[model samples]
Target: MESDYSSAKEQYAALGVDTDRAIQLLKKIPVSMHCWQGDDVGGFEHAGASLDGGGIQVTGNYPGKARSMEELRSDIEKTLSLTPGSYRLNVHANYADFSSTGFADRDALEPEHFKSWVQWSKENKVPLDFNSTLFSHPKASGLTLSSKDKGIRDFWIEHVKRCRKIGEYMGKEQGSACIHNIWIADGMKDIPVDRQGYREILASSLDDILSVKISKDYLKDSVESKVFGIGTESYVVGSHEFYMGYAVKNQMLLTIDMGHFHPTENVADKLSSVLMFVPEILLHLSRGVRWDSDHVTLFNDDMKAMAEEMVRTGKLDKIHIGTDYFDGSINRIGAWVIGQRATQKSLLRALLEPSEKLMSYENDGNYFARLALLEAEKTLPFGAVWNRYCEECSVPSDLQVIDEIMNYEKSVTALRG
Candidate 1:
């Protein structure tokens, strides 16, 4: 394997690409793994409550799903064992650890609600990122932040305020800036007579929620927009243009979820345009099939384009990549490992690109040469370098990881029943 990597290194070096540096850089880029994948996004908020609405759906009745916070953490650890490079755990507010005592409504949630998670992160050395749970609750039946009722809106606003405080606490405790992403399922099923009114209320609610200042070093705030959700096909309150304008004016990071946009839209192309106005952006990397259906990410062209765009623009540092898909139909642990590994592979391929050479060709008006080099680079020995990276990280590079996952399911998750 070492000799193969050496030979591949020589091949890449001919194109002015250093495979060793690419591996090291890929190791430094951490992909935030979403915690909800283990539990099918059925957060540990209220026992016996089904994940019915919220513009999100997890198909399949695959058993061995994590039923408790401890089990969820255990499954995540197992998944991380098979994945290469460093990573952060992304948690939703609904996943708060209140197992001992029943539950607290969203508005009354405190940092202590998530103290266990912070402690676990510290112990495991995995940094934490957070999202306010604005769906699946009774209050979220119609609207949340954009609700016409002042009381309902206030509840969500206060909940988000507390969530931001918790995000700050986690970042301070873990010694890294925790990104608090706000995504609400505030939209209408049919055409509303007052689209402007709802957006106005949403803007006001956001202002109130974000007014509670937290140091940027401790907590970075971001707002995510969606074109449409399950029951929100007609109108979505936080549309792309709405949040883009708000993010620019408020200087907040705009989060672009891969599954949130129209199917025809290439989210990779939007990164350079968004980054031109915003200092930094957050990405919710997910595969969208037909609509915003969060399918497990694959090593497809979309993934390649996203990675290539980041590399091409020289703005990899300006983006925070995070996985946001949940596939309950398959082994939950396998889903996490596969999605994360695919993302890493895409990044590795991107880093291996001969950007300097390609740019030189373009600068000399040699478009044909540039295109040829781009296409030729794809056939290079990226697989060898990826295997070498997995070896260095002490993880299985081939299908051997699948056997490990099967053993874990039989010995661990299967017994939960």
Candidate 2:
């Protein structure tokens, strides 16, 4: 591996790509891993609270779904052991700990409910990101924050407010700004009549939620948008345009989910445009088979493109990266490791790119040279660097992770059933 990386290092050096520097930077870039994957979005809201829709679904009855918060953390920790580089845990409000006091509904959530989570974070040395749960609740069957009914809107608004406070507490404990992301399943399954009214209500709800200003030093707010969802096919209240306008106007970080748009449209293309408006943005990486299907993220063209754009723009600091896929069809720990490594690999490849040369070709108007160089660089010894990185990180390489996963399944998850 060392000899192979030596050769690759020489090759990348010719293209002005420093392999050492790339690995160092990649080590610092944290990909926030979602907690939902451990239990297929089944929060500890109740005994058997599994994935039930607001607009999404988690298929397959894969055994060993983390039945408790302890098991979920165990699974996540195992996943992190296999995944390389820095990481943060993305947690939802529904995963609150009610050890002392039985349970608190979303509207009544307090920071104390997440105290255990913060303690877990400190023990694991993993910072956290937060999301307000807007699905699988009784009130979320129809509109939530954008509902015509004032009670429904107020409930969700209060829930989000409480979530923000929880996020702030997590950040304060961890000493890093915890990103509080808001995504609501608010829209009609069929054609809607009052789009304008719903949007107005949503905007007002957002204003109310943001009215109580929290410490920006501790918590940063982000709003996620969807083009169409399962029950929100015809129209989505918080469309990309809506959040884009709102995020920029309100100076909040806008979240762009890879699977939230039409499949044909590349989310990577929007980074350059959106960054021009918002100061910073959050990326929810996922694979969308249909509409927001939320498949396990891979190092595919879409992900690579986004990572490349992120690297090319030299905006790594301005981007908050996180994986958001929940596939219950397979081993949950394997799912997390694969997706997290895929994201890491994508960013590493982009970091190893001959971006400067490509830019120079573009500037010189040598289109053929640009395209040819781009195509030729693909065959470079990237695998060697990746393997070397894995060795350095003390984790299994791609060829080795599979065996590790199978071993884990036999020893761990198989016993859950």
Candidate 3:
């Protein structure tokens, strides 16, 4: 229903975003967002189990019990109200097991769970986006850091196939309702492995995962269904990010998380001029100081500078703004609202400022202030300019990040067929 690049320039304009530069800087802004607590609430009870390893000391206080599916949806509805763009619900398994009492399990691929999720989405106009388990309840979920190995691969493939079957099943009855979004938490942490091995694992896992939804004939099964492949960049440099380029050729796009980069890891510098490396989704927008920290959006000038740069570079087209916010103790709904609004406002400021300095081939003293003033103005009206910017800016693609995986599978299928 929405065009990929709707009113984006106007969004930038209303917020005093660098319209000229933003227009030239980025291409489209198909919005795909992330909400930590969705249908399943208690799934993350054991958040740091994998990090702590074996002994499984569940330290955090259980704020209360996790929210129910209905409560989670209400959170989503409030999120949608403020977000007002293309969105998909990040589906944690709705069951309660160690694997994540609230997230997915082998049962996620089960007929019942699949049907329930689809029915839920269809009734509420929400789509289920898949997030693989990297960390789960300490003792409950069987997730391990090394899950990128065969077991994890097999688990993902099975789940993917079941998801496809469910979609097909639903199409038979109610047309298409569910589109899958997948982001895997597989990669070596401290283990010893070669760079090549890392690249190989990433490439292979992606190939295996996407192979699920292959239609007898390639090309996505329908307009409503597509796979979005979210590939997180490395926490360290010279690691795996460079290798992700291979995904593009495989027909997979990227989703770079803001916190993944250090201050030195200037996202604008890295992605701005580069034409080949484009991402479908962008996460961790408000996480940490530019130099370090994860899942934090405390707000800083340097971060604002980064936002201005991204908009000026006009890379917003490839961006789907999100926050990787998840704290077990805090009110999940409130956390989501705060994080989402903070990140969205930051981007809106960047989108609205004039891009004169960015577009200027030569550097001048006015560059910082030109962008800084724009940022200030938005914050001045109690961020009303930021609000206006968000309201005005056009959303990017609504294609679930999973669509890329499905598309790739169709390619794989066609090649085989």
Point to the candidate with the largest lDDT.
2
What would the TM-scores of all predictions be?
0.98, 0.99, 0.60
In order of TM-score, best first, we have: 2, 1, 3
Model 3 / residue 117 / CA error / Å: 3.8
Candidate order by lDDT, decreasing, is 2, 1, 3
Write down the lDDT that model 3 would get. 0.43
Backbone clash count, each prediction separately: 0, 0, 41
lDDT comparison, 1 vs 3, better candidate: 1
Mind giving the per-residue lDDT tens digits that candidate 3 earns over 326-379? 554543444555555555555555665545544452266566765665555553
TM-score of decoy 2: 0.99
Residue runs of model 2 more than 4 Å from their true location after superposition? none
lDDT of 1: 0.91
- lDDT, model 2: 0.91
Which of 2 and 3 is the better model by lDDT? 2
Please provide, for model 2 over 268-295, each residue's C-alpha lDDT reduced to its tens digit, 9 standing for 90 to 100.
Answer: 9999989998989999999999754599
